[model samples]
Target: MEEYKIRIVKTIQYIDSHIDADLSLEKVSEVSAYSPFHFHRIFKLVTGETLQSYIIRKKIEKSALHLAVHKNMEIKDIYWDLGFSNHSVFCKTFKKYYGLAPTEFRRSAPEKFHKILQIQSKNGQVDTVFSQYICNIENLLNWTKMNLKIEVKEMPEMNLASVMSLGIANVEPSFNLLIDWAKKKSLFPRENVKMISVYHDSCKITPLDKVRIHACMLLDERLSKQEGEVFPETIDGGKYIVGSGEVTLDDFEQCWVSMFLWMNENNYSTRRTFPYEIYHTNFKEHPEGKMIVDFCIPVH
Candidate 1:
């Protein structure tokens, strides 16, 4: 079971980095070191989607994100860049998923995409907490109310020894594995070692069960894979809008919501990359039991 988790995660990382390429089942299964037949079943069982469906969904989501963020990129260009051979087929598939045509969606701009929907859901209660891609805009209040720092700057690439956080309630098990690996590698007791969580999917976008979070530590030099569970993935270094704060669990949600607000207000759109949080003071060890964290969003 653990080996399945590790291999799937490595396959996921490979898919992320090579999103625009020809990602056939045979090629991707090679990354997981599983045969196509077994890989299909294991991936579907673990991730709740057929392998082909997963690839298609990721490609669709990638196109949707581009349409939402990079408005200047033409619709044809976006579809073609994502390997969609036929424009009409691409538009149909996109609308089937997002419920809007490419032009209509782009026109809705940053609004419908970031819109925090507040309506009576099928469950017959007001479900206003999570939106599609971002959280409720109301989550922006606490950041201003508490006056945290939000700034934009250039960030360098981070070389990480990482393991995936299985879920919200299951982070500690993975964190312990990473910490023990770091300790054995003498990565601890060092000034530059930083613990970070790189979010590969937004909470609002992916289910809590399937979202990928890399709980990693920065290393002085990226060592070879000495352990199967601990692998290396590099976080891209470029321009990012960051928010720094001493926060609780709820505050962490607001920090991300508010950071998106900051980006929109400042005329910055997100780059096609993941956001990350750099941890300074551990909440468990802090005097006030709060975490000192930097929330980073990559942008063009």
Candidate 2:
């Protein structure tokens, strides 16, 4: 299983590096050294996305980033450069995925753009906003009652035991499984265990069912082989913008949206590491019935 995961990672990296090149199944499967039929199944199993869907999402995301950062570039040029065949096709696909045409998205404020992307589309139209307060910086500040403070801090490296879940809302089950395994092993004093969830894909661009969620527990070293779905890995240390707040499950999406808006407003670009959530409270039994979490995004 670990070998399969590594092969998928290499294929993902290859696709990313050659995003503008032909990424057909035959070519990608060849890169992974798997038979095309087996590669398709394993790719979807490991990454929670079919190979074609992954490629399309990456192309669209790259185009969106170009649209966000290169203000003066023509939308048609941007889409074509990212491998879209034509302007009309790009516009149609962008609207289908982001709920707004490229031109409208480009004109929107950063916060508004982010909010639009977060909206779940229904029948080819964006039906609502993720949160009313996600429209602008002033609204976000007002909604948080001026208490949404973000600080940039240097964090040390971490070794973690992790379990992966495919859907955003399905993460709790994975966390529960990890915790059960931890208890059986007597891995730590309950009071000292640190709970975290690492996000490996953007909800805005990736389908909800295909988003990668890693429920993790901080550990000093790798655990010996144990049953169930948990795996061990290391996270590199870096500078991160940490935003702490008392929030409910409903507030999770907006919290990260607000942090991203803040980063864009402050001209702080993100590093390649996945963003994560660190729980500081027993989320299931919090006195306020809200999770106390630190939203950490690696940034430069």
Candidate 3:
């Protein structure tokens, strides 16, 4: 599973760097090291959208960002640069996806424009529109008031076994795979195990299909490479700001957002290492179905 996720990540990265170029299935599948047929199926299963749809959405999104940030650039130029063949095609596709023409969207508030991209939900379902998702995320901000505590501490180096998931909504499968592997290896007895999740990309900055989340667990002694796709890595020791709380999966994203906001408000700068979460309560065993987690963000 890690191998498949890594392939998708690499393919998405390739697409991101070459968004203006031709991105046919054959080309993308080649980058992923999977045959076109197999790649198409797995890509859809993992990302909640067919590969072509993802590419089109990304191209349109890029055009939207260009429209919002580059006010002086011509719409035609933006469309062309984003790989759209012509103005009419770009306008039609953009309006269909975002419900707003480029010119009109540019004239409107920037916040609304940023919310234009539709979210690709997991389970092959899109239950809410982009605006509704934003509202839901806004509502989650209230979770910060529920006895959240944060402090700064230094952490020691540790070994980890991990699996990467391609997007936020698609993280559960990776976690499940890792847990199943651990169980099979008898790496249990909760007290001796530490579960952590490392986020490789910020959703706010990266496109959804390109985001990466690493589901990890600490390993005491080095074990030989396991059969399946598990990654063995070491996290460097560091000074970090730790935020602890009981939060449902739905509130997790907002928790991180609030932590970053807190750091900004308190005049702390984040370090180069990726922010991670240390789970104090087992996910399935949470009494209230809310995980007890410590969000650890490396600080200078």
Candidate number of the best TM-score: 2
- The digit string of per-residue lDDT tens for model 3 on 81-118 reads 88788889999999998899889988874755555544
Alpha-carbon local distance difference test for all models: 0.73, 0.73, 0.74
Cα lDDT tens digits for candidate 2, 1-300 = 134334555676688779999899999989987656446654554455678888888788777767776789988788877888888889888888889988887776273344434444442323332122123324445555454568889987888899999997788899888888888889744676799989888775578988998999998786665466988867778999988888887777567756765565566878889888888877569766687788998999
**Model 2 collision count:** 0
Ranking by lDDT: 3, 2, 1
The residue-level lDDT of candidate 3 at 160 comes to 88
Instruction: Please write out the lDDT profile of model 1 over residues 144-208, one tens digit for every residue.
Output: 44746888899998888888875665566787889887788677757856889988766654678
Worst 10 residues of 1 by lDDT: 129-138
Q: Give, for candidate 2, the lowest lDDT window spanning 10 residues.
A: 125-134
Residue 261 shift from truth in candidate 1, angstroms: 0.9
